[model samples]
Target chain A: MTDTYFVAVDWGTSGFRLWVIGRDGTVLDSTTAPLGMSRLKRNDFDRVLEESLDKLGIAQDVPAIICGMAGAAQGWCEAPYLCAPTRLDALGEGAVSVRGATRNVHILPGVKQMAPANVMRGEETQIAGLLHAEPSFAGTVCLPGTHTKWVQVKDGAIQHFETCMTGEQFAFFSQTSVLSHSMILDGWSDNAFRSAVRLATQDPVAVPRRLFSIRADMLVRDQDSATARATLSGLLIGQELMSVVHYWRDQSVTLIGAPPLCEIYLMALDVLGVGGRSLDVETTTLAGLAAAFHIQTGTVHA
Target chain B: MTDTYFVAVDWGTSGFRLWVIGRDGTVLDSTTAPLGMSRLKRNDFDRVLEESLDKLGIAQDVPAIICGMAGAAQGWCEAPYLCAPTRLDALGEGAVSVRGATRNVHILPGVKQMAPANVMRGEETQIAGLLHAEPSFAGTVCLPGTHTKWVQVKDGAIQHFETCMTGEQFAFFSQTSVLSHSMILDGWSDNAFRSAVRLATQDPVAVPRRLFSIRADMLVRDQDSATARATLSGLLIGQELMSVVHYWRDQSVTLIGAPPLCEIYLMALDVLGVGGRSLDVETTTLAGLAAAFHIQTGTVHA
Candidate 1:
C-alpha cells in the first residue's frame, strides 16, 4: 500500500479553508472559499469538498480531516462534542466519520463545558494545534475572534474554558445599532481604546452606560469617528477582560487569533498590567488539524 | 380674545400621541399615530400634525404644545436641550416655535447632561409630568423604554441623569444576534429572569459571558426559548441596575413607562431590594405637556 498525504479542512460558519499536507505534514497546496457551513447544505458539503479537491488537483482517494462548524449538527455530519477535562490529542477519537464518501473523511468534535454551558467548535482544533506545538504548555490560552475562548490547558489537557461574544457584539452594535452612526468602518484610536479599557477595568458595571456615552460623546463632545470605533472596541474587549482576566491574570497567557485583534487583546492586557504573547490562529488551526489527522491515521502518538 | 383648549403632543422617535387639554388640565380627547420622529421628514411633521388634528376635528386656530422628538433638531423645529440642574417646569422656556404653521405650535426642549453627556427627549416631558404630580418629589426617576433614563431629581429640578440603552440593546440583540435563535419573542420565564438578574448583580462583568451562555444552554441543555428570552432581558436590566442602582438605592424611585416594561424595571429594582412605584407614561407626558403649555402661554407658574 502506498502512503501519500491528506487534506486538513477548517470549515467555519462563514469561512472554508483546505490544506493539502505532505506525508511529513508539509503543506503542499491550499485553497479557501467563502462558502462556509452556513452557506452550504448537507449534501453540498460533499460536493464542495470534491470541487475543492478537484481544484487542488487532488485524487478522490486522498483522505481528509475536518474541524469547526462542519462538525455541528447542522453541518455535514454531526460530531458530538467531547466533554472537557479531555486530552487535546484525543480529539481525533471523538471525530465522526463521513460515510458514503469516496475518500476517507472525518470531522473533529468540538469541546463542551457542561456546567457553565459553553461550546466551542473550530477553536478546539486550534487548541489541539497549540497543544501539539507546546506539548508541556500550561496555564491559559486566549483565542480571540467572533467568539473569543479562554481555555486552561495543563498536562496536555483542557481543564475548563469560557466563551465571550465580544467580537460578534462589536460587529452587531457597530453595524446595526445607533452607535453605527458614530463609528468608522476602518481606522482606530489607540489612546481612546486604552482609555476605555482603563475605564471599564475601573468600573466594569458601568459598561452599559459607557456604551451609550460613546454616542453621547460623539454628539456632545464632537468625538472623532475613529475614536468612537476604537472606544467601542475597547469597551467590549474591556468588558470581556473584566470577566475573564481572572483566567490569565495569575498565569502565563498566550493569545491565538488574527494579529490585529490579538494585538488589541494584548494592549488590553497591558492596560490591566498583565502580560500576554500572541500566536497566529491560522498556523495553530492548521497544526492542530494536521495533528488530529496524524492521530487518526496512527502516524503520531496521542 | 377667547381662550380655548390646546393640544398636547408627546411625539417620540417611533410614536405620536396627542391629547386635547382644557384650560383646567382635563383631557377632552386623545389620539395616537405610529408616525414618530424617525418616520417623518422635517416637512412631514407639520402635515402629520395637521392631518391628525383634522382626524380629531380640531380647529387649526387652536394652539398645540409638543414634546419629545418633535422638538429634536431633526424634527419640525429644533428645540435645544435644557441643561440639567434646571427645574422641570422651565422646559417650557426652552420651547421652539414651528415657523409658518397655521396654528401656534411649540415644541418643548429636551434635557441634556453635559459631563456624562446624556440626552432625553420625550422622557423629559414624562419627568416634567412626574414633577407636576409630585412637586416635592425628591429622589430618582427611572423612565424605562428604548433608552431607559435614570434621572436624579432634587427640589423639583433634574440634577443629572444617565441613559442606558438597555431596551434598545435588548431589541437589537434578541432580533439580530446569534442569541435570537435561542429566544422566544413573547413568552417569558420569571424564574429564569430573576436567576439571571441575581447572576448579573453578583458578577456584573460576567454579562458578556452570560449572554453567550444562553445560546450554549439552549444547545447543550435544550433550554426553552422563553427562558432564554427572559434571561437575556434579566441580564441587560440587571447590568443596568448594577451600574445605576446607586441612584435609586438610597432614594425614592418613581418608575414611569408602559406597565409591562415598567414592571420589569420594578422587578429588577425589587431584586436589588429597592422600593419603587410605577406611573403611566402617557398620563405623565400629558400632564407634562399641559404643564409646559400653561407655562409657555404664561398661564401658570414656571
Candidate 2:
C-alpha cells in the first residue's frame, strides 16, 4: 500500500487553509495563510500556494484537494458547477495542474442555480459532508452562511437547491448600512431575535416600513443601540422568512453550519412551524473532499 | 404712514433668521447664523435671538417674527402645531417675551397630521409661501427637499400634507449603503433619474430585488459604479413616486422650493401625467414670513 499525504484545502475569499491528512484520514498537520484570492492576481496562485506550504514545512510533492472560492474563475482555477442529483461518486476526480508540484492538486466543483440569479462555491463539499455524516437522510438541509444554501437531499442524492440573501443582506445592513452605528459589535439578544422572528412571521408585509424604522427609532427616538441591532436583525431575517415561507411550509429542515447562523434560521423555522433538527456536519468540506477522493480511488467504505 | 420696518424671520430648528424689510416687504438687509434651537436651553431663547441678530448686524430691538421648527418642543419654545383647513392668519399669534431683545420675537407653529403620524415643521412656511405666491390656487404643492412634502392647498387654505423621506433616503443610500462606492458624486444622471421614475411607475414591485442586483451585477459582471447611483436613485425616486401617486393622480402640481429638488419632483410629476409647473418659490421662508408679517400687522401694499 503506497501511503500518501492528502492535503485538504478550504480557501475562501479572505484566507486559505491546507490540512495534511494521512491515508487513515486523520489530520497530521495544518497550515493557513492570509493570501486570499481577493489580494492576488490570476498568475500569483501557484507562488502563494507554494509559499503557504513552505511556511508549514511541507514539500511541494504532497497530493492535495482544494475547495471553496479558490476554484472560481478569478481564483486559482475555475471549477465547474456540479448539477443536481449529483452524488459523491458523480463528482469526477481531477486536479488543477500547476508547475513544479510533483503531486496532483484536485479542486472541488461548486453549484449554481439559474432562477433568482444564485450561485454557490465550496458548499458542495459541505453538502457532500452532510450526506456522508448522515448517509440516509431525507429532508431539506439548509446550509446557512454568507451565501445561504437550502438543499433538498432525498433518496441518497442531491435533488435541488435555493440560495437566499439572508446572510449577505444581514451583513450588508449591519456593517454597511446606517444601522451600523446603532448595532453593538458584540452581544446576543434573543429578545430581538425572537421579536424579529415574530415580526417577520406576523407583519411581513410591512418590511419596507420596518427597515426605515430601524434607523428612525434610533436617531429620532434615541432607542437603545442594542434594540436597533435586534430590530435590524429581525427585519432582514423577517424579510427572508417571508421570502422563503413557501419552502418551509410542508417540509422538515436539517440545518447545517455554524451555531449563530443556524440558530437564527432555527428561530425562523420554529416561527414557520417547520419541524427540523440542526446537525453540525463536522469539518464538512474535509469530509466532502474525502468522500470525493474515496469515490475516485475506488475505496469502498460500506 | 407708519413706516415701521416689517421684519420677516425664517426661524426653524437648525437656525433663526431675521429679514429687515420696508413696509412694502422689500428687504433692506438680512442676516443669519447657526443660532438654531439645538444650542438653546429652555430659557436661553432670548439670548440666542439676540446673538442671531448681532451676527446679522441687526439691533437686538429689531421687530422680527419667525416660523418653522424653532417652535417645536425642543426648539427655543414649544409652538403648538396647527391643524388643517387653517388659514395663514389663523396660526398662533403671541409674543414670546425674550429678555434683552427689545423686539417681540413671535414663533410660528408647524402643521401636524395625527392619524398618519406625520408632521412638517419648516415646510409650513414654504407652504404658506406657496399659498401667498399663488392664492386662489387649488391644487397639490410638492415641496421637494430633504423631507419631500406633498401638501394639498385647496380653496386658498392649507388643507392636508404628507411627508416622504425621499431626499434623506437618497442621501443615506448614496453615502452610507453599499451603493455609496458606485455613485458619481460630482453630478447626477437624468437618464438614470428618468429610468428610475419609469420603473417605479411601471413595476413598483421590483424595486427591492433590483436594489440587490446592483451589488451582484457589480461583483459578477463588473458593472460601473455609476449604474449603482442611477439604480439607487431609480429605486428611491420610484418609491417616492409610488408613495405620492395618489396626490398627483387627479391634480396639477405646483413644485415649490429650490431648483434641483423641484426638478426631481417635477420629473416624477411629469411621469405621473400630472400637468405641473415648477414654481421657484425662491426664498420661500422669507416670503412666507413676509406674508405672515403682512397678515399680522394688516399692512397694505406699499
Candidate 3:
C-alpha cells in the first residue's frame, strides 16, 4: 500500500466528489456527497472536508486540489476567473490555496470570455484533461449541462467559448412555467424530440413563440406528455445548436457530460446532420484533476 | 340616475376590473379587486362576484359580462375557445354563460388557431375594442404582457397571431435565474435596453447564449444592476421581436397594454425603426366590454 500523494476534489455548485491519490499517482479511493457551495458556508465546507477525509481514512496532512463553484466568490474562497484565450496545459497554475482550511487545499481558477461575457469553473479542468489526451486536437468541445459550454480549442489553447442556459431553461419551462402542467417527468418521444430539434435548427427565431405550443397542443391536439417533454428538450438543445452552428459546422466535435445528457445533445446534433463523440464527465473530471497534479508538480503517473 | 343594467368584468389571471352598465348603456359605477382566476376556485369566484356587486349596492338581478382568464377551463366555467379567422366585431357570439351564477354571467370565449396551435383569452376582447375605435383597422395589433400577443387584423377578422413569453422570461431571468442577484427591481437603463433589443432583433438565435452575460458582466465589468436588468429585458423582447418581424414590418401597428409595458414595446419598435400606437389597457378593456355589450344586446350608449 502506497502513501496518499494528494486528494483530487471536484467541488461543484450542487455536489462534491473526492479521490485519494496514492504515491503511484493513481486513485486509491473515492467518495461523493451532495455538498455544494450554493447553500453552505466555508465552515460547512471544512466540516464536510474533514468528514470526507475520515471516510477514506486519509491523514490530515495530505493536500487537496479542487475545481468548480468551490472557487466562486460566493464559494469557499474567491479563486477568481482566468480570462479566455487561456492555455489548457497548465490550468493548475491559477489555483488559489484556501488559507484556513483543514489541509492545503488549492482551488483551480475558472475561465472567462469578456466581449460576449461568459464564465466557467470546473469545465476548465476537464479541458486540461482533454488536452492531456489529445494535445494536438483542434476543434469544438461541447459540454452540455444546466449551463452548457461550447469551447473552441486550437494549438493547445482555448480560443473562445460561449455558455447557453439551455438545461436551466428546460427545467424552468417544464417545471415552473405554464408548460409544467402538461409535462411528464418519466416520459419521452424520440420522434417528437427529433422533429422539434429540426424545426428549431431550421428556424431558431421562432423558438420563443413556439414554446407556448406545448400548452396549446396539450389543449387542442392533446399532445402526449412524453412527446411534450421530448419537444421541450429538443427545442432547448436545438436552439442552442443554432447559436453554435459556426463552432460545430465542418469541425470535429466532442461532448463531455453525463451520458444521458450527452446522448440528448448527440441526438440533437444528429438532427442537424452533424456528428460528435461523447465522454463521461466523471472520468474526464478525475483525469483532468490528475493531469493538473502532474502538470503542476512535474510528476508523471503510471 | 339611470337603473343598473349589467356588470362588465375584466377578470384576468392576476387582477380584476369591473364596470356597472346603466340602462342608458354607459358606465354607471365601477370598482376593482385583486381577484384573478389563477388562484381562486370556481366557488371562490362566485363569492367574489357577489361581494363585488354588493360593493356598489347593485341588485342580484343585474347580470355580469366577463372576459379574460375567467374564461379559461380552470376558470369560473369553461368558455370554450372560439376557433380563429375569428370575427373581431362579433366575439360575443362565442360567450358561454355561467349556469349557476347569481345572475346571467356570460364568460366570453377565447380564440384558438389550429395549425400553429396558439390561443388567446383576454386579448381578443381588447381587439374587439380596437375594432370599435378603428372599425376598418388593418395590420398588426401588439398586446404586450407576461405572454405578449401579436394579433393580425384584416377584413374585419383576426387572420393570425402568435404569443411570445417575453415578459415571463424577463421575470424568470431577473428574479429567478442566475442573474437574480445582479438585478434591481427599480432599475432603468434605456440605452442598455435599446442596444440589447437591436442585437436580439438582428440575431435572435444568440439570446439564450447571451443571457449568462448579465451574470458575467456583473462579475467582470461590474455591470450596473439597472443595466443588467434592462439587458435581460432587451434580450427577451429582442428575441420576441425577431419572431414577429413579419407581423410588424411594413405594417400599421397598434400596441394595446399597460402604459409602462407598452412604452417598452414602443421603444423596442423604435429600435427596429418601426412606428406604433399604444392604447391604455384599462380603457380598452372597458371599451371591449362595452362593445361586447352593444354587439350582443343591440343597445346603443348615448
TM-score, candidate 2, first chain: 0.88
User: For residues B1-302, could you state the per-residue lDDT of candidate 2 as single tens digits?
Assistant: 32447566666556666677765567777677776676767677667666656665675555777777677767666667776656655553432433444567677777665443356677777767766666777878888776677787877667766665567667766775545645544456777667777876686544544554555555455657666676677676776666566678887887877786777767766766768887755466776777766665566533
Error of 1 at B39 (Å): 2.7
Off by over 4 Å in 3: none
Docking class of 1: medium
Ranking by TM-score: 3, 1, 2
Question: Which regions of candidate 1 deviate over 4 angstroms?
Answer: A1-4, A184-186, B1-4, B184-186
Error of 1 at A200 (Å): 0.6
Q: For every model shown, what is its TM-score relative to the native structure? A: 0.96, 0.69, 0.96
Scanning candidate 1 chain A in windows of ten residues, the lowest lDDT window is A1-10
Give Cα distance to truth, residue B4, candidate 1, Å. Answer: 6.0
**lDDT score, candidate 2:** 0.67
* DockQ per candidate, 2 decimals: 0.78, 0.14, 0.78
Error at B101, model 1, angstroms: 2.7
Q: Of the candidates numbered 2 and 3, which has the greater TM-score value?
A: 3
State the lDDT of candidate 1 residue by residue for B32-134, as single tens digits.
9999988989988888989989987888889999988888767788888888888988988888888988789999998887898888888888888888888
Model 3 RMSD in Å is 1.7
